[model samples]
Target: MTFKAAKEFNTPVGNYCYYHISRETYPIGITQIKEGNSVYIMATPEKALCDLIANQPGINLRYKKEALEFLEENLRFDMDKFCQFNPEIFLAYAKNGKKSTSILTILKLLQHE
Candidate 1:
């Protein structure tokens, strides 16, 4: 299997919904929302990411299901375009060692891309 020494996905267990990525050599796991965006990562350098979204004092807004679909369709792993903006995530995967480590987004695992 190409995913023999695969990576692990670090996401919230339930109510907490921030899918954070940290330093860990996992066999296989899911990090990003297997469905949407509005990634709710923790501001700290921790492995656990959760979505802490709430209405502001005056503004009342929420990430709708459609918005998530939009993100997945348009922004999901469009690294060719999005990397210019935030390159760290991509860099992390690139800097990964060839034999020692491998990073594959859940999408790739789906299509075996």
Candidate 2:
């Protein structure tokens, strides 16, 4: 995923695979997992959710209500697990990623909950 806005493309590999191109440095939470001879680099749950919010088009969450609606109604996210996410990761993403206002709104929503 990328911090900068660019054309989004999908690779046809059974399930569609989308990739983001980055032009600047940004904070990301990732983990490397190894199984036998294979290693996989994956984004943490916090980072994945942040990336989804930041990268998705037409998402302009500027208030707690909007953020909450998107999370609960649109995404059907489990509110029980919402509070478990690391706030610091969202803060870091908000600092260096796109859609700062939306990201901050999410942070604020989390805090209020």
What are the per-residue Cα lDDT tens digits for candidate 2 across 1-113?
A: 64455444555655443546354423466678899999988888878887888778899999899999999999999998998888888888888787878989999988885
Q: What are the TM-scores, per candidate, against the unseen true structure?
A: 0.20, 0.79
lDDT of 1 by residue, 19-58 (tens): 3322432212224433364663223211111111111122
* lDDT of candidate model 2 versus the reference: 0.79
Overall lDDT per candidate, in order of appearance? 0.28, 0.79
Q: After superposition, how far is residue 100 of candidate 1 from its true place, in Å?
A: 11
Q: Which residue window of length 10 is worst by lDDT in model 2?
A: 17-26
Instruction: Give every collision pair in model 1.
Output: 9-29, 9-30, 17-51, 18-49, 18-50, 18-51
